[model samples]
Target: ASQQFKENLTLVATHEKKLELKRSACPKPGPGQALVHVRATGVCGSDVHFWQHAGLGPWKITDCTALGHESGGEVVAVGEGVTNVSVGDRVAIEPGVPCGKATCNFCLTGQYNLCPTVDFYSVPPKDGTLTRYHVHPAGWLHKVPKSMKWAEIALLEPLSVCLSATLRAELKLGQPVLITGAGPIGVVQLLCAKASGCSPIVITDLSSERLDFAKKLVPSVNTYQVDTKKDAKTAAREIVDVFTNAADMGVQVMPEVTMECTGVESSIHTAAYATQSAGLVFIVGVGKDFIQVPFMELSVRQITVSHLFRYSNTWPRAIRLVAGGVIDLLPIVTKTFPLEQADEAVRHSADRTKFSVKTLIVDGEE
Candidate 1:
């Protein structure tokens, strides 16, 4: 069972905006590393963004980089000092690893997501796990339950994100919350909020179709379709009404917490405007370089605006949530393609008309 790989087909994204399968030498695990037989990699919007733009923020593609971050695999080999995972262990890969330096304040304090030297997978310059085989830190490989499907395991990455955000929000039982955006993250956030016992959760999105999917995921969620033609204030007032109408919603004036997952300018404005005074708005989505915020209103209302940078110490809980049957992620995986068609997978993910919540590229049908 410890057979080494001679070579593997790697899906590569070039600076010139080309995707092709390149013959790559299988990488061997070094000390504290594990060689993973990648079973499946889920496509994120960022993956599609990088494949189309060849860069994101400060990270630009100077050479070909494999594009995929959400992946789960089986360990094929373990290097020296590797003990967390063994040969043939089914595991989910936590794609980001920060420089484990005591001198760094963020890493030392366990907020490694903010570590300046963090290496994030599929974020340009760093090769990701879209290939059949990948080498990852042993400590980052979380052993998932055998009952979890390979593609479903890949979903742990996104689920961890929502879980981490919800934890940061410090959700109180029966508290009303607002989740802006019905994309993959928003729906998962709904699940996390529900698990935390959040009541009368309200979600807003521009597309009725995406909101419909979220409604199906959580029928109790108050789905609000945003009219883009309306200004942020107008939409915000309507959202407030959804929660303040005591006759309709429970004893809540406005949502105590607002988790903005869209990263759009107006949606963010709506979140700020709609959240109750002294409430918290957790920014889960990455927005533009410069977004106009209502500084005066936020300052006056005493609303705390916090931005989430990936996750920290959430992989194990994420694994447990699914393995323990607290959540089921199979529904989020709407379409799957074989490894050879990774380009199509990314393309499929980018196409709004396709409207698939999550698309996966697997080593093969599994």
Candidate 2:
């Protein structure tokens, strides 16, 4: 059915640090776009980050815009030139769409994620898919296996980030890897690392409860609780000590790869220190504009550092892993809310005491 002139319920970020559900006009599909019946939308850290501060990094909410990007649903209608997917197809929304112009260097080279002109959902000017009906680029919609649940499809965006981190780190099989932060990203990284055959993986976080929960989520993962009071160097030394003794040869050693999922400056420093010489440090977290790095130590050790921006061509692999049961995505979701409670859902996502690892807003059931 045509969404034109149809009234729908949408969650909007109106005013300073406020989220409210409002009635809005449903969007109709234009050329190369499809109208989707948004079934599930996962609230992300960025969404909370935006709502808490009413902005993120360089982007601020100037106008009333919906807040949600990690989403998937059924295509109810397709516009002209849209043939990849059809009505009634269950699909995962990629969220970020670059200017697919021929002159755009980033898009032409298949590095669309790097395109400066990209319009990402829920990031300032672009309205997100928090409503019952939304129109999105047809190419950005990926059909999921029918067996995949709505929640899993919605979470594909974050899973893509985890896959990008794993790929950028160039994780080697059987190599010891260190991960900092047990938040959703860190937990997902743990899964990706294990799936890549990384052995003796170590994860750290400030919350002992989160660390314990990480172990419960992935029984094989070795978790450590970081002492926030201690300096990064001392914490790094202590973490390395555990690895030194756990080495196969019982010789002093450090992890070959370190994925810093926490944006804390201390965690970044600790990751650099815990990684062995000639190893790799993957900075998967976003932080301040500039961070102090131990350049001398990194240079002396010849450690390679890399960072990932969203993801590049990772959805297929992420989908297969989840659909094939190679990775269990459901465990990451700790709470679910209806669309009407989006404001509460965002608040719960930011409050650690609420025990919400991930919060989802189902389109209906309010």
Candidate 3:
């Protein structure tokens, strides 16, 4: 209620590979919005990429803005018409809010993530929640139980992506699934597939440590490391062989679905080759803009390959999965840093050491 209370500290991405801590005016919640006192924010790969590359794909940072999207905090204030949340409620920020207009086909069809006018957090010119306070559409904020920690609540953002990918794959119980890459997304997909009753899920990566970490999370999950020196064609064949031979012993039974969480070209090829005919392949990772693949081969196999952007309408389910103990993300969070050390936090996240899985920037003790 005082002028001093209206100032917020923000971690701004000032330039390429640089972040500066500065004071910013706390934003006020407008109608249908809620002002959140951000408690913790996760350093995502995209956040690190934006800092290192200054942009992603065609989106470039046009201005100096805060740089975190996966965050959670308490609702401190609300605007008129906000009914779902109240002051003092803990919530996870969804980060993406579509242009609320009925004329848009994507929004009208319930696929708001595809809305061209959507403004996602930390995507170029947009300032993210890497601040002590933030304002967001109340509809995009999902409440969490008081017992949940802020870091865990913030992680729902990545989990939402995994859920979207799992949904797109049309995953079924007892179906075999293949996932490429042992990065955070791939690991999350592994957990989601396991919860969906997918049996004998296989994951591949370049790091044996990451693969071992995946196995630690789920002992039943099968992991393999890709040989970097091998030719792509040969590597793909070998990767596919593991999937086909997983359950039937030496019998060669293909997985019904493949979730390609690695943007690597070879991994994509392996995903296509490993899936059974009439199966689905979901490109879940963000990678190079263009890469050559065995399209004609996949065409003959009648496998469908699809790509998903950010999630839509998935926060509630993600929260349910974590709250119900169907998924545990705490193990994935390996490091934590305070707001003052935000720059170092992102840099650490960029490094894929044997122990680095997920990193968090906390506002305080949480």
Model 2 Cα lDDT, one tens digit per residue, 217-282: 989888779988888789888888777665657677789999989988889888888889999889
Error of 2 at 178 (Å): 0.4
Global lDDT of each candidate: 0.88, 0.87, 0.85
lDDT per residue for candidate 1 within 114-184, as digits (tens), equals 99989997876679999988999899889988888998789999998998998999987889899999889
Q: What TM-score does structure 2 among the candidates reach?
A: 0.96
Ten residues in a row with the worst lDDT in model 3?
1-10
Q: Is candidate 1 or candidate 3 better by TM-score?
A: 1
Go through the candidates in order and give the C-alpha RMSD of each one to the true structure: 1.7, 1.9, 2.0
Report lDDT (Cα) of residue 267, candidate 3.
Answer: 81
Output the better candidate (2/3) by lDDT.
2
- lDDT order, best first, reads 1, 2, 3
lDDT of 1: 0.88
Candidate 3: list runs displaced more than 4 Å.
1-7, 248-250, 352-354
TM-score of each: 0.96, 0.96, 0.94
lDDT-superior candidate, 1 or 3: 1
* Candidate 3 lDDT, 115-177, residue by residue in tens: 998999888668899888899999989999887888879999999999999898889998988
